[model samples]
Target: MAFGTGNQIRTAGRFIRSVFLGPQLAAFLPAVMLGAYWFGGEGVLLVAAVILPALIAFAGLASRGLDLRSPRDSVTGLPGRDHLVRHLDITARATGGNDSQARVGLVIEIDNFRGLQGMYGESGAEAILRQTSERIAGVMRRDDLIASLGNGRFGIAMEKTPRVDLETMIRLSTRLQEAIAAPFSIDGARILVTACVGFALPGRVPDQTGDAYLAAAESALAEAQRSGPASIRAFTRAMRPRVSVPDALTKEVVRALEDGQIRPWFQPQISTDTGALTGFEALARWEHPEKGRIAPGAFLPAIARAGLFERLGEVILFNALTAIREWDRAGLEVPTVAVNFSPDELRNPELFDKLRWELDRFDLAPERLTIEVLEDVVAKSDDDVVTRNIAALSKLGCPIDLDDFGTGHASIANIRRFNVNRIKIDRSFVTRVDTDRDQQNMVAAILTMAERLGLATLGEGVESHGEHAMLSQLGCSHVQGYSIAKPMPFEETGAWIIENQRRICDHPRLPRQAG
Candidate 1:
């Protein structure tokens, strides 16, 4: 009870500090003074000033802190994004004036930060950010500037000195990564953090602006992120051209779709309790004639940019339905095949009609098809077409699964509004469920909420026997990831079914057949 009281007092103190120190307090002070004057005149005003002089002083500090033109981040007290950009601009101009001098700009992103925020609450995440910023600051030279780039990302501007070379910058970046990668103790839990570093040297692009350098650095950062944790990539000329090349590749994506080169690969979903095959998620894969097998990440964005998502979605849907029909004919008891619907595809008025037509054309049961919607799309989009089509699909007996459940701005309202049938706990939460207590608690909460709502739960990215067992013990209905099976071609799926049949039939706990 004493601890609870102390917590409440601390919470109240934080509220008071925020009220006094927040930017809006300055705007509200005059109204407050006026109310004071109107109610009790000079005596009350004097009393208020005497009692609240510290607040008034803090408000003055807040005004300076809240200045829009200020270069500092309010939370971390480090240089903000605009400050870093402006610093880059100044450095670029200075370097342009002196042909011998150059600058290096870097962007560092904390990978899986959204997952961290999900496991730890906002305050805990902010505490980690503060510690991260401080550690990065500790690694930098006095002249080098680091700034908060928002969203668990940071920007660094380093002016090239006579003592510093490309090797020096590389070493500095490595040091920064090492410092940040060290475990942080927050809220009594030790959490390991990893960062992706991307750096650009001005010598590489003598004619480009600071913003251009930053963009190049971001490209390198994206590549580093793709390479996974604690990775670094330096910007190169080849990366620059690849930016514009996506436009050309968009055409290739369209061609692939039309030429039947884009095909659906099935990643199996299994029941956690029974180890039976539940369903398959139809993932899109492109077989480019020239490039060979193109990953979806390489081409899906291009397809979306070309406004061909709807067409590509249709092709995937058709292929998935055809595969299900073929599996049925092959005497495989695969129950359903899930296909993702992008926001644009969901917003299409013809979505329901197209799905209904395809289901009827294949003579497949509506229950045999699952429609997956990303949580962000359902939570953030206010499209009537999407809303109506989801409802229509639900009414047509197609189960709706909320994909990437914990990573979005999803709420109870969103689940209720969309009438979600199943919630797929994102890979972020499922990755280390067996080891991480926070992850275990998060998954348990999600499962409990889903259970009370009468919705099923599937854990995506379940990779180990331990994770699968833990999820089953926690009441997750289904699991999917590489541990079960990689996404395979339609032809191979039949053989896989035959190979796994005995395990399915022999399990002590037989899973209820999924529609």
Candidate 2:
């Protein structure tokens, strides 16, 4: 029979009780006469025969009781592997979907489940599994499906969801957060367990069956697991392809780095107070022979994977320093030029020595180059090692600026730990400064903190007059945004500077560009 509902069980229990206890008492009374008849006389035999039907009814009632066994594991009392598969099969047959709007899957694997087993023993792991299962079961709806996909990995499938309905998906994620956040009790001790979840929406329907949506979810889940516990990542188009860059293209990129095809485009950084060009933040570009010019984001990661970042950093630095020397010769009076340094470049023990050697090679003053380190790399790194390297680089007379300051989780700690020369507010904040109260407050707080620490501040991504006016009012000393100038090639920057100098000489305040 179908398991039916809880109300059915309760009604059944009551009916069984009535059969045994209501008019059923008369049936048992005759059974007493039958027992007496077996010992007494033939007259009692008639009474015993009449009681037989009542005895049968009472026996049926005795069998009705609740099954109280825990259906799943103790640590995560999720159902056993077979039970999970059954759940998946039922759901897949009934409601699974093929499109992004209609399908979603979750693959959650407890990070290092066996490590906990080693620490607490097999029995301890069992207890944890039971508790974990109870929590997970409590969080899920009756109709939703979950399956133990083996080795501490569980799969969840949500049918009929769209990318735009991600808020609903996030609500499901909260259940996982709650389940993992609550500490599991194992052997009289509370052990905190953390897990990472990877999720995907089915792109197509199964031709073969056996929960194809579950498999896609598992793939996304594995990526999240590799990234580490507590990290969640969704599958994207980039993760779908396994294609490698052509060998010729790879070689061309490497060749470009070696042949000085790489150059820095200096976007002028303006002084909010003086409204004149203060410096430039150097951005790297490759004038590929075929592609013409490739943005850094398009190919940098691939190049870094091929172990070319250190060489690439050196090339960009060489070009930027060369440009700085030329700018000085042209009497630009620029104070600094910020160049981005990759973590791969910074982590190199000999990076400082190599930078010094390059500075000497081009006769560039160390004070003119401000190395901009990404916040994420600095935050994740061995701070002591990075701090020492930054100090050594500082002693060489070049300052260090913390780039993309508010972008990472550990920004505040990074600012305090490193002897940074400047903090540039990330463009995301500056782009909407006029309308976003939170962004305005964040920018204000960063400026206030930098001032107290006595470090210079630069606001990046100032695209409008309102943004510029706001930053100026808040005493942001250095600013870079399209309102001033877009990132241009070095030659263009030079031309714009001459024009700006002419305009300033004519009028004290630079006029706003025509809308």
Candidate 3:
């Protein structure tokens, strides 16, 4: 009867304490009972029930102590900004007390954080952050405090750092940069990480906030990042820009097409051997009402970012075809029209079906239309989407021209893997060919290879008579450049082609100039 009464009392006490102490203490009832039984005292149960919760609370509080003796990271197992601020304060005071040597702050940012998230997904992004934290920690000294400021950014307080000795610190930063650049395998894909580092000395810091040092470092890092990937830079006041436009410009560009602002300009392509007009390539442009004629350089990049490249392609194609038909009706011999296609256009399965329907509506021949594809798009994936699209175009008697060859990682592979009828040498190699022997040799070899493969070659950026003669001798089938004719409006191109036809028939060798 006595044992039953005691057990009942103990059970009642646990329920009351759980209600008063809440969930964290309620978990300790079993341990308290075991401790009470291990000690040979009937009265010890009452003491243990109270003592266990108190001990647990004390241990939790002790774990969170923010004093210097506490663990570098707080109870959250995350290093707090207070740790960084405390170190900076100590270093500033110590170095300020000495009037000669100065303390410098370095802030390192993980370059392309969003890119990693895009390429590797969220879990991979978090893993990269954790690994970066450990790497920064490993490079840190006992006196040099490090703390995570959130995201993939970290701050460092270099104690008693000297301005003249910044070279050694930069070398250490270089090692960190190289370590990040080294390839990492994640989720069956290889990823390369890079960082932009910024540094500051005492008086050179920004805003005088606790994060001033870190901010200065980040500012320098941003300046370094303009060149891209694994770059390091020191912050400068001159590098800060006054205005930062929002990404809403992409939305403005998307609506530009519906607003009748997006249109095409035609550039003429002439036969290299005969200097006769063969075709015109359609290039997109946006005539912004406010900005005044935004080049493809400005708005095309935004269009690409907004994932409207296919829509852009379709608009250009329809406009070009309409222009070609108008020119044909006006008694201009429209030899052929070439339209460039982005990777997105090739991957779109319905691109061909939509194209065929449009061509039929306009009564245009496939032989008179050429599709210009980038060399980079061919090597992006092994999906065979582009190859299949090219084959379908070929079946329709459409000539597939690989544009910007020798510029990307796999230009030669594109020729071997994809069935292309023409190869256009990138302007970079063509412009330098006359001056550089190696460039000339490379262009000659590519031309010879294309010849053996029975593919027509187009040499772009032929600006001089000598260049034209060299390209013709080298067996380039087509030529397009400023010397021939720049990209112009549809009506002007029609007028120019008529004059060239009259001149070519009259005096075959009379080097024709624009009328």
Candidate 4:
């Protein structure tokens, strides 16, 4: 009775075909028998009845077999891309006149899907794909059409309805992201797959083809993939061809690295209880000749696209270490300087050696530097190189702090695998802690977990005194954000430190302690 199995449906179809054909053949056989007159009436009737029905049944079986083999994804049972396009065309034509009704299309791609498929064999991979499809289907409305675009990509079309405004569509897309990001169990191995989602809204262009809408969505998808895992981007006219930096600018980024034009800006991390400066996180800044000062968001992608991420990291590391050494010589008592490492930089075979070389060059200890890695970076537990590098760094005595902790799906696993020494609660959670009970509870839970794990906690982006006070009460070890101090160049750090010392001494609310 269950239609879940394809074989069962095929069996039922065969039975229905036999029933239809048997009656038609029974009537035809009597006429054939009378015309042929090859035997006595009764004898001819019997022979014709059996022979005709058998022949008709054979034809029906063939037709049913073809229907069962119709174009569909063999694994997920979703329609093929061609069918999706046809459906979109129909919707476009049906709603062409209704200006209020606009069609929205989405393209969802599993990030690093091929790598997952390769790790698990064909059967296991197919199971994951089927589960992913099911999760997506669970979130869609009855009228929304979904299809397999092959190569671990799925397409969705949501026709405009009274309830489905732009905001609703965005919320739905976010739900899809969360759905796919949930952990999966395949062949006794637990795995997590993030998604890159892109959407295209109805455009103003006259008579835009279905392919154009799909093309726009794909363009946005590419942008999301470059941005990172679990990213969502919406297509716009400006994003028509693609989003990219010029090759000349990329080359200049490389030159900037070599010329020491990219420098480190230090943001102090202060103790919540003692109000003493504990450390500084070295943030990268580009001193472009024409641009004057370029933020990391502007040039970091270019550097990564140009495959110069490792070089940029090296520059940042060298500069941070040099600044720390200089600070020490200036009679400043800065305890530690944290430097960020990208996933690619962490996986480099010479990462450990490079760190050691930089430490030795600056005549500094490894403990003086904290290695900050993004939560998503540490989530790649399957990468042996990444895991090994992290272990080596930890063994070398550099504290590993998981940056942007709660934003990622793999926080607990990352902490267990990387032996993290600190967890920096992301600003999103910290910024609203004072106003939102849910935010406060979430921060409380994170601090509780860190305490149990014997790890330190730092509250980032603490722009308000309420947030700072809340974090302090919650037992956060350190705090860093606009409220404490803005990131400044090496030359300005001494003056800022002196100013902060004076202010902390003047204010009774802030407790002062020896550096």
Candidate 5:
């Protein structure tokens, strides 16, 4: 069931108390009018009839798209993303395909924005964004289009000018970073922020369409982010990931799933205490016959774009359950296989039953298959079906592992509310836990909290022996990353498990202290 529709909002109370005005509420006008009349008189009923439609109509337009005089972001007072894109398109066309005169498009994404949101609250995050946006806008020319792209991102369309080059983009990116790095004060507390920047030069954006230019910049921005915080990258042909598939990504995703090209690659997770195999996570991989391997990041979006999230989830679930049974047959003693479900799949009213039937069909115990939910889903969920489905899954004995812990809005209350069995410490904190004092302190705090709550903890992205030693000392139950074992196909798991079993060391290998 799509979360965007009424299936998720079956209750009248939820509809009434919903913070955002939705067009679906249009159908409830008659009921609302009757309620108004019951509570008040003809005067109130007349007032409701006149005012409700206007509000709904305005909200509907805003929800669909703001078509009138280009909309501005409420917090930043800058143009919205659409306005920047439109202006970029106009500027690009006015250049008449002349690369020298074409405008540049850049995107600046605030680093760890969600972490800031989680730490300081939404309003604090907004204040940071507002101040940062003003600084960014000030860095650009008065006429150069600047936009608030939401999610701690800003889009910039440079005024069409000649002599645009990589050097110019780099200089401008530096200025933007400087602006973002400036400390922000929210209620007497000073918060420092950094941003990654990506820009596409006019000539690099092939069609010079606003959407294409923006996408190129975003791709570069992704590259910059991958490099590190406060990094900058100019768009290049190589930045775009190549998936050796059909011309259309969406089309290829549909065919790949049907042809069995997309499947699970199991990454082993081990007990940090004993280094014994506890389980493996079933991460999706697309293996093209010609290309050998395709990155999930490249095609997963295509799956979502094609509205195949539910289908993808079904495929992964079946593969995971099958893997668990296979491991059982091989006497591997692998306890469970974790599979992630998209928000759309979690919202399905039939998810609980579907999972039960799948487990039954595979003749596997419910505990043998772990269900992984993103912290974002737990944090932002408003759908009744999602909440009920998660609770039902927990009741049925399947462990729920919240993925990317500490990165999203999931709180202690929400974690308990959703029956989370385990928290996977995000790689951000785990990256330098062995040598970085700050990283060690953060992981220690998270582990302490988890221990207090009696929740199992796993640290992700544990890449070094020292880091593994530190996490073990800090009392993480499990660890998973390249240091343990990179993801492998089902065919390789048997031998890999056998070989890896010999590598298991005793608990407390050494009392290594982290920085």
Candidate 6:
């Protein structure tokens, strides 16, 4: 009974400290002063003013590392970014700038969170954030500080411990991803989400400041997101993401998209056995005036945040058709142009009409433009409009090429339902297929499945001649990657096409391996 009473007293003390010393105290301070003036005159009001602030400051000083001045995130009930950074600074200072005593800083951001918010409402998005935070906290130690960094991102500062290292952080990152990626249900909708993780190890950090550590982790997270969904990246000396201010970056993205600075750069896809030009995939690239060439990774998030995905799609589709038409006029026999459509764009009700109009405008066959869709959309999307749009396009003679095939765990039924003509194998399975027996087996299995399903297979990311040869011998119908050709602007494609034809005519195709 005595222990229970002591515990209750401590809890009451914590409540008082949190309320009176937290940022919420600002809300009630004016009222408290007003009441004091009404009841006890000017002297009491002045006394209350000084005493209240001093008391709050004293309460804050009593709780070291808590950072009472730091704000809180209403969505996840975690400390705000300021609090985590403040803790980081305090730790750095206390440890006397010793890397041996420093801790790990992690940032986990849900991939494509804007898409979720666009599909569902803000309330539903908040629910996901809350659940994600809960999962993160459940796996963390009590000493670990978790903060909501806004925009579907969370930050964690782990307590200093010798047990934590690179391998440990990697495992923890994987565990956190697993916890967050488990199916979420909100308002009768089942949502599947994945997160990219970035962490700063003390030993690898060049600078000792709190901002430096946090920025490094954020940079790594940005890099991870570029690799694909659920990817992880650790901080390196060369990684820096988004040096500009938020408002500045947003403005630049808006102008870049509107002023034709952002457009498609085409990459050629070829027949592996014959080295013939089969098609070209239209990829988005941003050409900044002063920055030279900006990677899609650096600006895509800004584009999504600005709600201009559909507009970007319009630009790509237009550019792709223009390229094809230009090639036609130049007598270049580029068979087809492949354009990818995001799930949000695919869900547009007028997508079918828009595609048909674009085809009519270009005076090209529907088969001349291939529609590429991510496998995740096929596996996870339940929207009837997306389904209808894809079906209508397939029926209209636009070949449906499924992008990043093996990553989404898409079933055969989903493939058949969407009428996918070709499945482009993800680079994860194709990275080193020539030397890795396991990769060879995996490619073989996929090829066998594709053959049985009557779906053409294309091995993506063929980087070396050996990988190219292995893919051809595996009976992969087509291949696309840096080995064949990097993405180029329309003007450069003519020269590349001519050069590729000359080279292939002089070289012999690798023969298939007999079973």
Question: Please, what are the lDDT tens digits per residue for candidate 1 over residues 48-130?
Answer: 66655567676656544423465677678887867777777867865662424766789898877866786677997899889
Q: What local distance difference test score does each model get?
A: 0.80, 0.67, 0.70, 0.78, 0.82, 0.85
* lDDT of candidate 4 over 67-99, digit per residue (tens): 344498989998877776766676666566243
lDDT score of residue 372 within candidate 6: 95
322-423, model 2: which lDDT tens digit per residue?
787887898877777888888777777788888889889878788888888877666777755567777788878888888777655455666666667888
TM-score of 1: 0.59
Better of 1 and 4 by TM-score: 1
Better of 1 and 2 by TM-score: 1
Number of the top candidate by lDDT?
6
Better of 3 and 6 by lDDT: 6
Query: Could you give me the TM-score of model 5 versus the true structure?
Result: 0.58
Ranking by lDDT: 6, 5, 1, 4, 3, 2
Error of 3 at 348 (Å): 0.7
List model 3 lDDT by residue over 159-257, tens digit each. 564442456767878977766655566776545466877776556554444456555666676566544445677666665521122477799977997
RMSD of each: 14.5, 13.4, 15.7, 11.0, 16.7, 11.8
What TM-score fits each model? 0.59, 0.51, 0.52, 0.53, 0.58, 0.59
User: Tens-digit lDDT track for model 5 on 1-515?
Assistant: 35435545655644563434677777888899999999998999999999988887777665534346777788888778788888888777767557677878899989878777876788998898888888987899876778888889899888767678888778889988988776678898645567899988877777767887888888788777756567798888766542332438799789899888999999999987677899999999888887556666568778877899999988888888888888888888899999998999998999999999998999988899898999989998989999999999999999999999986768889999999999999876786578777677788889888878889999987767877888888888899987777788999999998877777643446553452
Model 3 is weakest, by summed lDDT over 10 consecutive residues, at 506-515
The residue pairs that clash in candidate 1, if any, are: none
Q: Evaluate model 1: give its lDDT.
A: 0.80
lDDT of 2: 0.67
